[model samples]
Target: MINAINLNSKLEIQAEAFIRFYYEETKKSAQQYKERLSEVAAEIRETGTYTHTKQELTFGAKVAWRNSAKCIGRLFWDSLEVFDERSAKTEEEIAAALLRHIEHATNGGRIRPTLTAFAPQKPEGSDIRIWNHQLIRYAGYRTPDGVVGDPASVELTEAIQRLGWTGQGTKYDVLPLVVQIGSRKPKWFPIPGEAVMEVKFEHPDIEELAGLGLQWYAVPILSDMALNVGGVRYTAAPFNGWYMGTEIGARNLADADRYDELPAIADLLDLDRSTNTTLWKDRALLELNSAVIHSFKTNGVSIVDHHTAAEQFMRFMKREQEQGRDVNARWSWLIPPMSPAATPVWHRNDLTEREIDPDYAPQERPY
Candidate 1:
């Protein structure tokens, strides 16, 4: 009984913290929301709970995206479509909403950045979680010789398997969604194939590359992160954005820890692998980046190259200054991994990390 009382007291504190943060971030007249604030305070006093209005919810979600330090894609932060799914408390309802998210973000190949904000954490209820790293991701499997899939997904793949879900262990196997409702056991839901759009990467110059069978999804929908709107934490808010070519070409496909296809790509080009000075790696990287950009363009999918993306980010910064908003960013992320000197962001030292309200953050994993 004492524990319950302490939990209720903590909830009241959290509610008040969230209220203060929200009012400050939104910059709306407090007098206009006096009645709403009073109602929230009353609910916290009685039931130890509170809710946000749709306007507040939308504004919070957008600002969170804007404050994302690691996202170079914040140039389109205002373009994010926020889907308030606070009512999706059940596992089935959440699964249905995820499907809708996939379909909408795919957007018939012209991917759209979208966010689905679920219920906030409650004192008495369990927090909802999507265990998958992304709504759509390839599975990684542990094998006798070596890892047969994406090494990054190996942990989540095993977790999904523990939840009674299995994948074919192919080079490109879409993993099932592991949805958990509060303290209840997690369940797996298979995504409809039609909702996911993938493009096979083939270099414009290399005709034989198509036979290698490499493809990537049109949108990257990250699902594991928590969305902290003001002080209110939403554990199941999944968000997505259109791909940046280098993210796929340089990191996911080229990284030694990831796909590690650079060696094979170099070999196919018949380049000298005998020494590091041959510039084989550079040549291979260019071809890979070209393949990704060309494939997306051929498939009529929306994708941005690193150079162009950096240029757009400069425009975003200028616009933010005009609006009298501080542009906080992570320099390492704002610069592309493939070619740092080629882009203007490389020379800029203005990017710095700062504490900002309403941001998406990484959650601590249960050990």
Candidate 2:
């Protein structure tokens, strides 16, 4: 059985201690990956465009960008483990025990590198603010439900503990865990001797900016190295990841606008005339499909003949280029629905029935 408990004082203390241990381990791991860190930083400075610059860097942007690399490094040394105990023990004591075990596993019984202490804040009213550098910005929150399972709960609790201290009345607080795994996305490792914890948090509107439906949203799109020409890599500009959205289309348009000198390349790649409503949507879907296929192929799990398929795609693009025609791919209108009940068969917003009448029966209603 899974239990959900509000973090009390003792539990908070245990969480803080566990976070301290995590940070110490993370800092050490970061130090070890200093070379990789430098490379990633240099890559960003050289390749990344200035989305917003006002004489200095903003904390939010810095955190968003650098945290990805920092976490990759942290994963090399630290791992999360959950402990499931059937013994009769208070939640606080269990949390404390988990912290002790984490400490033991992390530093061989000694805390070396100290953690950066952070105080969680509970904002008042509907106008919630998050800090960017020293400036506060308004953000909305949408509470998401937790996955229904035992392991998920364990993961959730451990994740909460890993994020330092939590303040009373704070909602949507996340504990940032850093790991060094050389990848942008976080990889899940199974916790030995325990079920993973199920956790839920308020989903942010920023996620919608990813553009690939609500559920498929993820940040800082993963790279497609297979499509790289030399050391130069191409990715969907706005979202960076393979997923398509309005923002990504906007970026493509922006790139096309920069094709004044390379008109031939522009025509070859269908950069020009790609902004047409139907054409752009089609291209987005194809690019998205390519990205997905490439990811699966790279992971060595795809059934498709990746090398031959990639060669075919490249040849198609080349043929289009030769003919001075833009390589515009069409997207299918038939996007699969997320679930059976996800669709609305009909809608009458006004004077709508609030509940399904069980006594009325299904056959009683007109089909």
Candidate 3:
């Protein structure tokens, strides 16, 4: 069909563009670039796709992080460890690779930025898919009282339950890893306890905050994104950077739709919650975020607070400017949920989110 021909042609064009970009960034010889481009052209002509060389894959993976407009951690983009799992086609193989990713990235408790590139989808889109939004996440159980765990996970948790997974029915019960190859049925594997590193919530100044029983999994590995390098789509590529404090505090825990801990936290702290002007939510958020940062540091985990992370993002923009690259960013994402005006990014007027190639795109859930 003409559609197939057009798809192949687009892939060829994207392939050449990425190769040129790669060579430019790496300062490899023009002859080598041309040779690689020619080989890719031939491969696409015959098979409708071309495989990325290990070097190309590595560079491309890093570039994808750099091109991620929503991420604030691009300053450390080059430090990402890429684990190539393109040959992993079975459920056990993929699950094993993901678990290994967890252990390696957890790094005893100091999390490392990592990405595990899985099998790339064909031109028409058939390859591996990870059903979980994150490799290690809390489950949700709906009851007459309410959702007992992460409310964000209610849908996935129900689907996972349908797949015969039973959690321990706790607020912090880590979910299993679910992976699917092609259109085959997905399989769930309980995440090994040894690979999971968790930081229990504790306050540096407020000792009573510990009794709330909040905890978070270390190393937030996003497993549902498709990493697009040139035209090849690694449908199940899971990647992670260490968490920023407000992400867990101001948003994940404090959000009313999420854990909604502010009310209880406010009550515990004895803040006046009778009216919005009392600023009870603001007070609670500050303590929650402080507790998160303090606890993570106490447990030897890598976590960045919003202020430093915002400054670092600006530095990243400056570095890109020095390299004659236009910086693209999303204003909403760059501004931390806790204190927007306190960060440099929130005051910026020119933040625009323009997406580029070799990026990680959010894919629809295969479940």
Candidate 4:
């Protein structure tokens, strides 16, 4: 139990933080937000909360990406393109906007980090949300033999099927977008082929490995989170960053619960798996990572390896410090899972875990 008074008090605190950050980041005259704050205070007194203006929403989206402590790619946070779609009130409108998001984010193979903040959830209105973890993700199916698709997406895939959509049951099939507006039943929209840009991975050392049929999308657009600007929560804000090579090579493709390609890769490399000292998994992982890097680079796709990503993060921290701002970071997330110790972020103790406002928050899975 929470009471209305307590909730409003918390909202006031969040409002202050967002307004202060907005003024600082945009260098807007303090009087502007002061006047806006008075209006927000009045609104809260009547309705328990207030909404953000288009300008505030845009800047808040960018700063939220900047405050994502777990991201090693925060160096380009300021470059995020923000789309304000707060007026979108229908499932059809949202789905159309999402398609535009996919195409703009794909950027004809050069992915751009983008965020589209839709209408915020209101006390009297239902939330507008995208049920999928991402706007573009491969489908997963649980078959009698075993899982036939991305194991991570099995639950979502089943839910989509139940809603009257079908997949080709292929490993690389792009799932349809599920849009839920207010209290309406969720609707499915097929993503156009031109909106998705996938890169087929091939190893420079092992050219024959290309025949294995492994590939991944260029951008990682996470759509299943709430974007909290001040105390106002936008439930349908989707955002993305250019993928790091390790995210595709080591985690998505190599994680045991996901694609789980390590064993197959080790067999192809002919590494002895009998002894723990042989480090067959490590050898195979390095090859896979190398292949991902080489493939993305050859295709002119924007990607960063763990080492370079860490180095860029360091530069971001320095720049923030020069601007009299402290960098908040979650060490566990800032360091890549594949080679943690080899990166500079692993040895650093200066990182802080302080929570910041205008940030994206993980929400419960809709399915």
Candidate 5:
């Protein structure tokens, strides 16, 4: 419950652990660490909470990303570009900053790992929050047949529609950025069309697959999650890294609950989908993953294949090992969705998934 944390004796204990880790990582002097700890304690005694310095905010965010046990992309955790927007109070300011973040992180197709943290939550009052699961996502409309877009976004898409967002009713309609400051009514700001970057899918060899016309956004900036730095809860922090090919191909497009393009893809491939023994789904998934990887590389958008990403994750583990630090990882998540048996991480018998401080965590939905 990092998001719903209250001022209590445990607050100081958690804050101390985070600060101590920060000092050890930064190699700051012992005296400076002690003084800062004292200051933090006094501030908590007086105001029930304390503010993080700019350096603390940035470094703590990177640490949070590094501590995300479920993320296979943690190899690039230290390279996260942190944008501190803690001073934003108005919806306009927050919206403008979000737009700016998209533009900067998009980086003209070479997506960068980036995060922007807004004002932290108070002890009791309105807090800055963004309702969208991701800064960029397609709307889902529940039609008679099924969901027309990303089924994962049905609740949010319906929520926005009720809020007076009249979409074009298209399969890939970009959802508006929903922002809320405290108890005020949430506001929906339509993102400028050009700000969002997408890569259209085109198979390298299967020419007929192009006729399906699939595309996915370049950067996946998760907006609804919270970042806990020490004991301070920055509830409006959004962060993203370039996606692994399997994430889009194996899961988003192939999963039955998501876009469910497997049957369509199998039809294009002329595979024997008559029975599960034919393994048509597996063949279709391979081609789909190949197309996603090929399309992204052809368009110059940064995306890594599952195998390469796994290699990088191993490197990250080795680097942490040299420092005598345990690499907390979730085995199931670290294994690629497409070919779990093909990756080294999948063969491991032990994988620890423990909660670490200064980490990214899910918060109670504001909507």
Candidate 6:
């Protein structure tokens, strides 16, 4: 019923409408997330234990905005199919439109710049003194494979190139960057076509740097090492416990008897059960379930069959519960806390060891 010209016209209109809707929604969502992040930053600042500047708060807000933007962008991409199916545009064209929309949505948003200090002047043969609480050092190298061994190898090099680094003159080139004394050694180097930069700092120093006015590109610190004291921390989930259902076992047995005829549903249920831990909240559980289902369907399994398998698994769980068996059982254990040993030295005074009380229980020591 539709000619090529008419279809093309419809495609253009749909593309425009999608982009407009996406841009507005993403911007609105980003702003909302940013405001919430600012509130958190303000709370941290009020504690006074950690000195956080306005710049640090702003940076945190920007990070929240970026994350929200990314989530919105993904949503837009997923919804593109509705537009694609209704219009006559090719898949590639639809994707391109979505990409452009994302670009427009993210452009000119709040950004934090990389902060570098001037090289501290040290007396000859004396170690350099770093004043700030944190110090970041950027090192350059040339490798054979043109790739760094670290996970950010490709991205680091691309960012460096974007910053206008070209390997023209020297066998080893140094960018206009500064290094701090007593920083940790880097584990990898960038290859010939690539370049690497290492950022080193403690939390206070990072907060200070984020506040400084600079026009450099700084990536949000997302590593676990960046989040914890000495990179050691523990997390707890409260809702972890046994789940019981009466219909579960019978349904499981029935499904097993017709295994080949019904398609292997055990694997699907096992995967779903394995993932439904209290460690993740309700929203995360739903998202993970959706992802698992999508993966199975993509691998040539029918959605209807997947749904049937899920229902059967639920019934099986119910039967197990009726038989006084746990459908799900979750437990938690404490991860050992981290502490550094005090510096050992010669003692001047003779000290006596204290005696333990007879009624006192022996406490277990953590390594």
Better of 1 and 2 by lDDT: 1
What lDDT does candidate 1 reach at residue 57?
A: 80
Kindly list the per-residue Cα lDDT of model 1 for residues 242-335, writing each as its tens digit.
Answer: 8899999999988998888888889889999999999999999999899999999999999999999999888888888998888889998889
Candidate 4 structure quality by residue, lDDT tens digits, 1-367: 1111222477787786677667766777767767766777778778877888888888888888888888889989889999988888788899999998988988876888999989898878788889999999999999998888799899999999999999999998999999987778999999988778889989999976787789998889999999988889999999999988899999999998999988888888888988869999899899999999999989988898999998999899889989888888988888897888988888876688786787889988767
Residue 72 displacement in candidate 4 (angstroms)? 0.6
| Residue range with the least summed lDDT across 10 consecutive positions in model 5 | 1-10
**Model 2: how far is 46 from its true place, Å?**
67
Runs in model 5 lying further than 4 Å from the true structure: 1-8
**TM-score of every prediction relative to native:** 0.92, 0.18, 0.97, 0.94, 0.96, 0.17
Q: What would the TM-score be for candidate 6 when compared with the true structure? A: 0.17
Is 4 or 5 the stronger prediction by lDDT? 5
Candidate 6, 1-367: lDDT as tens digits: 1111111233233322322333343454645444443443444345412222233322322222222211111111111111111121232332233223222322232211221111111222221211211111122343674322222223343344554554433322322221112233212222222222212211221233222111111112111111111111111000000101101111211223211111222232233334546322233223223332333233332222223433433454356467563322111100001110111111202212232110011111110
Off by over 4 Å in 6: 1-7, 19-151, 154-200, 203-367
Query: What lDDT is reached at residue 308 by model 2?
Result: 37
Least well predicted 10-residue stretch by lDDT in candidate 6? 234-243
Provide the lowest-lDDT 10-residue window in model 3: 1-10
Clashes of each: 0, 25, 0, 0, 1, 17
TM-score of 1: 0.92
TM-score-wise, the better of 3 and 4 is 3
lDDT of 3 at 193: 84
Which ten-residue region of model 4 has the weakest summed lDDT?
A: 1-10
Clashing pairs in 5: 126-182
Better of 1 and 6 by lDDT: 1
Compute the lDDT of residue 321 as modeled in candidate 1. 91
List RMSD in Å for every model shown. Answer: 4.7, 26.1, 3.5, 3.7, 3.5, 29.7
